[model samples]
Each structure stands twice: as structure tokens, then as C-alpha cells.
Target: MRLFGRKNGEDDSAERIAEFWRWWEGARPGLDAKVAAGGRDSLASLAETLAPAVSALHSGLVCEVAPGRNAAHALVVTAAGDAELRSLAHRWALAAPPADLVWEFHPSRQANPQAADLTLRAGDYEFGVGKLVLGLRVPRGAPRVDVSAYHPIFSELDDDTRLDAALLALDSVLGEDDVARWVGEITAVTFQPIDAVPAVHLPAVVADLASEFDGEQWVALEGKTARGRPLIAAARFPLRPVDHPLYDQHLAVTLPYAGRDGDKLPTGASVEALRDFEERLTRVAGDWVLAAHLSAEGHRIFHLYADPAGEVRRQVEELAATWGEGKARVDVAGDPAWSAVAAFIS
Candidate 1:
């Protein structure tokens, strides 16, 4: 029940990250000894050192030690279902010390096969994973899956506590990262429904649904600006914010091209320059992170999402400055909900 990390703004730099690893290298032996001796509060007791060090990287990030997949333990840095901080947890895990026999690193809570037989206690309620039942809902024509969880203990707990346990059970089976990406709204019910499947089947059910979203799909959206001016956009389908939890930060680039046939889409030599801009921007992105490419009124707007820790803003701004057609404007904002592109996404 003790959450680790500070309640202060994060310091995103190499210094804090390096400092944690340096401390980790020295503390490993002690930690291993404590765990090996079966200390009841082994990892939890390290809040003084381990907690502050990690909180320095990002206040929202918290760590816990769990039964490992292969190693003796897994040092998991989890975002606790906060999509905005998911990327930061991943970044922190990426900077971990190389793998060793004692510990493995995880960016998010992972599926634990052992959890199936585990009994979890919260307040006066005690329950095991086996007591849980799951119901899945796949919305028609949507790219995601919705899940409902049922447990007798839920009937005794408050709404918030019940949901916390339900999510915990799901994360234990489906893994945090995947659940964040592929799963949508979660509902908690005290009684098992006829359609409810056993908790153990959640992984397979979610896997089958996730596989459907494996390939890329896009849709064209035709709309008009506030002034009633016509605009068109090509955007990815199944545009769920959960799909790209890490892409919380948003970037919008306004590229003005002289050549266009009133649709505002790029044309002539301007088309080549816009493509070059896209290529350069993607290199900065290192992937096709474009949320949408829209032609609005007289200018072309590119909607993009990225990790705030990355130099996306600076890099994209630099590219805009070198725009050939005319002066380009780059705007960036933290948009973890991805609401900026709502108009474009179908």
C-alpha cells in the first residue's frame, strides 16, 4: 500500500538517471541478501534510497519488486495506469543497468503466472485470482476491446477500491502495457454474468483482439473549419488514445505552400518540399508518428504526437524554419489525451 516516489516535478536529465544506476550497482548486493533471506518488507523498505532516486527522474514513476519472469526478481517501474507517465516509465527502464542474475527490469507491470494462485488482501476483503471472472466486449467497428471483471469481494469494497483490485487482477494476467494499449473502459460487477469467462482467459482474449489491430489502417475525413472553409484529412483508424499512451505530447506544424488547387493540399515543387519536410520530421520521430495530415483553408497542418522527453519540439521547430515555400510555424503542447486530433480521427 506504500507508493514509492516523490510528489515533485520530474527532472528529466541524464544526471538523475545515471545517479540511480550508480546507487543501484552498490545496493544490489544488500537488496539480494534481504530478498534471499525472505525479508517480509525487502523491497518496500528501500523507499528511502530507491524511492527518492527514481522519483528524481519522474515524480509519477513508482517501482516495485516482483517475482521475475526468468531472473530471481523483476524491478518493475510502472505508471500505475497513467498514460501520460507511461513513456517516462519506459524511458527509465531503458536506462537500467544491464541484466544480471538477481534482477530483471520492466517498464510496466508484467503478467505474472504466479498471480493465478495468489491471494490479495485489501482492507477487510481478501480474494484470490481464481475467484475472479472476466467479461469481454468488442465494440462493433472499433479497434479496441472493453473488459468487465467480477469478484465476490468487490461487493464488499467501495467503488474505488473495487476498481483498483479489478484492474490489479487484469494487469496480473494481461500485463500493464498491453492492457493500456489494447483495452478500453473497465467495469466491475459483483456477480458473474453468463458471458463472463474465467480470469485466466483474459490474456488469450486480449491477444486475439490485439492481433486484429496488428496492421496499419487509415481513413479519410472531410470537414470544414470554423469559418465554413472545406478541409480534408487522412488519419489512422481506430484512433484510441490508449493505442499510443506514450504519445501524450502533441505537435502541430503549419507548412505554407504556394502551389495548391484550392484544396490546400501540397502540389508542384511545394509537394516535393513538403515530402522532404515529412521525411526529415519522421527521422526526428524515427517512426511514422503522424496522427493526421490535414489541408485546412490555405495551409497544410501536420498533427503529430511524441514523447515529451524527446527533442521533438526543438527538432520539428528547426525543420519548420527551413520550409522552402514560406515561413512555417511549429506548435507543441502536452496532449496525453490526444484530443487535438479528435477532429481528424474518424
Candidate 2:
């Protein structure tokens, strides 16, 4: 009796599947062409048939079906009545020619406008046919889901009950052939786990210094001293001199500091002091000093990219007299190595 019932159930499933295919084939031409032509009426018609199925999967669901590449179909599912429809329009795309599908879900859609939390992908792996940008978010107090079955989709399933129901539905609806096809497509795509890449480790002192100078104008490099103390170096390109014609013949002047009153550097003193000193230097040197660098040894190196007026040395001397307090020794060089250093530091 059990065997007979199983045979009957299989026959019924096959008949239903055949019916679905027939309906799809009849609707394909009109739906595909109209959607490809960007017809709203056709989309609404297609949505009438598809929306219920998607809504059953998720409450308050909005479903959109449109033409995809080569007479294929694309489906976008989102929260109902979302005013920002354009943002979710590309969430799920399906192509039938080579049997491809792509799905992206943004858990923090409002907080992060450009974030894609989880991505489900299948089909041709190369030429970007099945590519996904993965960085999923798990709700703070939600239960975790098993990831072995479908890693990307699993990352999205924070509600355990919903996940179980969805899994059951998927298993019931998908046949052996369907599962095989999906598995094949999924296996074909390549993916890298987010945890695979090692995190950058910075010493505490370097991190603190970097935080202080973090801005659009400066880039900081972290190194280590002889005794393993964190050494921080920074570079900045002055906007004023960058647009000048004499930008290429710059000389870099290095001035060492020991934190004494006469050898104090403005950057080491305070952020405001650094800004004030930079402004004064720019005013005095004009277009000659195009950039600047603060070395790990606390040396302020000025990039005088042009010395057309032969005033590079004079400018360095003036800077030392005004800000260096008579203890700073200015070494000005116009060598090719200095230019290379300036290029690198800037």
C-alpha cells in the first residue's frame, strides 16, 4: 500500500510540474518581449501570477518580474511598498540560457545604502556570470542557521522558525533534477570566505597616532623602532603648490626635532599648531613647497618641487628662523633622490 501511494504521489508531482512548464512556455513570449521593451503593463500582468508565490515565502512581500539577458527572467523581491524600489530592483536576477541566478540581500539597507549583506549565486563562474559580494549581518539576538546547505542564504536566515519553514518548502518544491541543477550551478561558482583574509595588526602607539592625523590631507605609515616602539610617518600634499607651473623642480628640506623649545615640530605639538605652521609655511614659500612629510624620526621634510627663483635655501633658513627657534638644522637638497623621496612621501 505504501509503495502504491508513493507511485501515485510521484505521478501527481510530475503532472503538476508539466502543467507549470506549459503555463510558463505559453506566457514566456509575451512576458519576455514586453518586459524587455520596458512595458509596465506587461510587468504587472506577470507579477499577478508570481507575486503570490513570493509572498508565500515572505510576509509583506513585493515581487517584480522582468526580462533578463537572452529571453530570461529577473525577479526582485523586497519589503512591501518600499519607496526606494530602484535600490532593491537588482536584488535577484535570473538568466535561463545557461541557467544562472543571482541574489543579494542588504540587512542594513537604511543604515548602509551601498551594503550587500548576503549574496546567493549560481551558474557560469567565469566572466562575472556568478559573482557575489559577501558580507552578511546576523541580527543581534536571533538564532543561527546551518550554513553547510547554502552558505550565503544561510547567512541571511536569522529567524530559526522562518528558516526551517523555508527549508521545508524548498525541499518539497524542488525535485531531484532541480536539486542537481542548483547544486551543479552553485558548485561551478567560486567564492572566498570573509574570514580567510587576515586582519592588519597595528601597534597601540601607531594606531593612536594614526587616529590623530586621520583626514583627507594626510596618509600615515606605521613602522617599528629599534626597540619595537611604534614609529609613525605621515605625508601631505599642499593644494596651493600642486597647481603651480614650477611643480617639478622641487627641493626637499629636512629638519630634525628633539621636542626641545628650539627643535619642536608643530605636528608633534598639537593638531591646531600643525595646521597653523603649515599655513605659515605655505604663505612664506608660496608655490615652491608642494608637499610635506613627517618622518618616523620626527623630521619635518618640506617638498620644494620648484626653485625657479633660487630661493629654496633662503626659504628653509627663514622657516628655521621663524619656527625652528634657532636649534633646528635645515638640510636642503635638490638631488634626484630627494625628488624621488618627495614623490613617494607625497
Candidate 3:
């Protein structure tokens, strides 16, 4: 049997395919007349013969295949004779199959005007393809034709496969020269990880706190500032002598202060006070404060992994005296041992 308009004994060469497209391009205006004169059998014959090739090309274009249908359908969006083509397609669809093959010839002007006069651009073709969309744009001048392939049978395939299929489809429709140009104009897509807050370490204070607690553990804390910058710190807590080293420590602190409106710490004097506080704690307590934050509530919270109980009390007293009383609070895990251990360590 003949396939894709090829005669049983006809030459099946790439050159022949090119010739067919060229002929179709030139003779497209008269196709409706030809079909009308050819009658139902001729249309069915055309559909049957073109089905495989059209389906293949569509698969390549969309990187997908329609499910449950033996025939392939295409939607050609163009700036040429769109209304006439749509009417012709509608008239054709009214007939019963095997002549009832589905195809659409649309004018981009009536649909997406942006795509109507689109030049050769490189980006993802979000439309046209049903699911396995290509990430390349075919170069076409104004008053040009753009093809879209659709299939209902869905399977999730990788990007590379879909792209390859798209290129192959382009090769069939626009031929190798056009496909090569498209490939040259193609752009790549990339992904990035979300930004993270920087981490802080305070070994000396951690060691001092470890000495007071039966056992001690440390953790990293992360949050965001009002302006969306990262806020990170380290935390320490007490563990019982019999507790496993890996056991979770409940004692911790969350730092910095923000305004009620989710604003960062005041830019001037408040900033100075915060820096001075960090420096003082480092000097007196051996850098136990991993990090600090100014909360939206106008409170400066300090995150500490280790605090000798007595030293923490003394630091709090001194900080209140300097920065104003009740302006800050130290958060620790609520355990009697955590409080008791702090008492003895300081």
C-alpha cells in the first residue's frame, strides 16, 4: 500500500518530501477547489495517505502522540487566508469519515497577534504543543505560517527526547535548512537554588556551656529578615548525663528584632546598639552568641548554643543596663535542667 501520498512504486526520498511541501506551499490557495472536485473518496484517500506522515511530523513538533486515534490532526496558525482556511476546515469536518480527519488552519491575527508577525526568536514554545512542548522558536518573517501539533495520548518524557522530536518535526515541515537555523537560534533553560542565610559559629561559648550541662548539644537556626535577607544562628542546649549525645537539646534562642510592621532594625542608633551588644557578648562570654536578630516587635533576640548560666545572667544584666532594660530577651529551651544548669554555670 502507498503511504503519505506516495505511490506504490514511487520514489521515497527526502528530496521528494521537500518537493511536496514546496508544491503545497505554492498550490495551497487552490487546495479547497481540488478537494471539492475530488469528492469524499479522494479526501479519505488523502487523509489515509497523509495520516502517518502528518502524525509523525506532529509527534516531532509536539514531542507527543495522540492516544486512541489512528489518524493525526494539525493546527496551522498563520497570517495567510486564515478565515478562508477556517471555513474550509469547518466545511470539511461536516462530512463523515473516513473523510472526517481533523485539521485546523487558523490566522494568528484572529488568535495570538503576537505570534502572527513573530521573527526568528529563541524561547520555549509554551503554546501549540499540547504537553511535550518545544523550547525553541522557529524563525519566520511576517505573513508566515506556524504549525502546532496535538495528541491526546500522554506520556511524560524527558526534555531531550521532546526536543529531538520537535526538531525532527521541524525538519519534516520546514526542511533541514530551516531546522538548522532554528537549532542555531535555540536558547537553554536553567534553574537555581533559593538563597540561604549565612551561618555563624561560636566555639568558645559553646565549650563553656558544655562544661556546665550534664551533656550539651548544638544546632543551627535559620530565619529571614523583614527585607527577606537570611538570618542564621547557632543554638546550644543541656543534656542529661545518661542522655545520648545525639539526643535533642531543648535550650535555644532566636535572635534579632524587627518592627511590628515586619521592618528590619532601625538603621541608625539601634544598629549601633546591636553591634555593640554583639561585641560586648563576644568579649565577655567568649562568643557564645551565634547570631542575633532585631524582630518586628522591636525586641532584639539572641540565639546562643552555649551560655554558662551565671555568665548569661551577668551579660543580660549588663546589656539591660547599657541598651535599656526589657529591650531584649534570651530564649532557651524550657527545661528545669536548662534553667538550673544556667544558674550554676554562670
Candidate 4:
């Protein structure tokens, strides 16, 4: 189910990246002249040529030309908001020519909230970004925002086209990376929901909310497992998986307790012991996040995320080996999306 173009768990080829950069440097000059002169034929040729060069890096990657912040035109090679492909776009950007009077490079679409007249077309419908309104809902105890959008023109298109248009407009304003990182679920609404706000104001709203998620706050929940067993779970209240993208490894430390009470929950003494172990483990597991934990079935599981480069997994393994509280089973794997413990927050 992986949607990104890089080979699963494999590094993208360096020589391939060099080849594309080599091609771009040679082709950029002529393309720049014709593009600046507004030559339609040259624009067509540039698009066709650029597609393969970018695809050579990753099939899922996309590129385009736009007015630039650093120069007259920007070559924006982007991940189109797919978080997994961001690194590919970044690698391409790193190899790009220096920004000059006519050229610049962008790894992702930069936000342009002041494009007051920004308009987009999809299917058979066209709408102004300013005319769009958004319905935002942050689940009472959850970490993300779910958005519903409305535009007068949505009435003219089918559901699929309507959603696509809404997304494209949002992506243009917020930039693809932020949209992918911060936004959860987005759908098109037929009518403005209860407290819809103007799309132009969305940038500020998202910024304010993002700042809150960046804070330190944690919450715990008690429930029953699907098998009707008692369970206790805890995690950072506003758990943002993309907050630290480099921490792509998932580590699960399972400690079976002989101290479970009648209800299959931890006894008082076991709870204190588990907490101390977590504090010590966390201190040594540099750049690690205890994403979530589950206490059920006579065992307490500590779900974690960490940067492999920090030797976090090795450090944690060392701690687990010397533990006196039953044999600790530590499992580690690649999960950049942090899907393993998402249920605790969701």
C-alpha cells in the first residue's frame, strides 16, 4: 500500500540524480529564455522534456515552472504533498543550479497567501481561491484538523472533481508540504458548514493550531480491547506523526507483568516500576518519542519512535537486556508514518 515511488526501504540512486542534474543544467538556459519571452511552443517542449528528467528521480515526483521568490522563474520539483516523497524532491533541489536573475529551485510549493486573485480550474469548473470557504473541526482530544470546503462552483462539478479542486486550491495557498504534514482529512462540502471561514484566513488559522500541537501536553485513555479485556493507553495529546520525520523507526518494548490485578491492569507497584523504566529509557533514547503505550493482557507495551542515526534502537536494546522485570521483548521496524501506534491517538 506504499504510494511513494522510491524502492521500498531502499535508498534512491545517487548516480541517477547526478544524471538528471547534468541534463537540467544544459537544458535550463534555452528553456529560461523561451519561457521568459512567453513562447508557447517552447513552453510545450520544456514541459515534455522536464517530465522525464524529474521522473528519472522518482515516478511519483512532479515539477513545474512558476514566478519565483529568488528569481524571475522557479523550477519547483515537489512531492505533491506526499510526505514520503519529500526527500526525493529535496535531493533534487540540492543538486539544482544556483538561483540567478532568471532561475531558482524549490523543493516544494512555497505558500503565497497574498495571491488575492488566485484562481484554479478543474474538470469543467473554475473558482477563485479567495471565494472558497473552509469548515474546520479539531477532534476534542485529537492532534489534527479535518477540513471541509465550499465554493459556489462546487455545485457544477461531481464529487471527485469538487474535492480535487478544493485540494488544489488549498495546496496552492498553504504549500504542499504543510498541507500534507498538517492537514488530516479534507473533503468538499455542498453548503458552508456551521462556522466556515474565508480561505484567505486559513493560513493564519493553521499556523495558530500548529503552534498548539508543537507544545508539550499528554493525555491517557482507559478502555476495553476488542476482545472485551480491560486496557489502558496513553500518548502525547496532540500527537503529530510528522513533527519529527527523521525518526522513521518504530520500536515496541513489551514487558509482561506478574503484577496484573484481577482486571488485567497493572498493580500499583508495577505501575511505579514501569514509569521509572520509561523515564530512564527515554533519557538514553535520544530524539525518541514514546508515541503511545498499551497496558492489557498482563503486559505493558511501550510504543516509541526514534531516529536510527542517533543509535536510539541500540541504546534501547541495551536497557531492555539488563531489565529485571520479566524478559523485555523489543521489536523495531521502519514506519515513517508512525502507523503502529496511531490507534492510541485516533
Clashes per candidate (backbone, < 3 Å): 0, 5, 25, 0
The 0-to-1 C-alpha lDDT of every candidate, in the order given, reads 0.76, 0.38, 0.34, 0.77
TM-score of 2: 0.29
TM per candidate comes to: 0.81, 0.29, 0.23, 0.80
Best by lDDT: 4
lDDT of 3: 0.34
200-238 per-residue lDDT for model 3 (tens digits):
111222233334444444544566756675544334432
| 136-197 per-residue lDDT for model 2 (tens digits) | 22233221111112233333344553234322222222321122112111211124445321
Q: Which portions of model 1 show Cα errors greater than 4 Å?
A: 1-11, 39-49, 224-229, 238-250, 257-288, 306-325, 332-346
Q: Runs in model 3 with CA error above 4 Å? A: 1-264, 286-294, 307-310, 332-346
Number of clashing residue pairs, candidate 2: 5
RMSD over all Cα atoms, model 3: 28.3
Ranking by TM-score: 1, 4, 2, 3
| lDDT over C-alpha atoms for residue 50 of model 1 | 69
Model 1 has an lDDT value of 0.76
Worst 10 residues of 2 by lDDT: 106-115
Ranked by lDDT from best down, the candidates are 4, 1, 2, 3
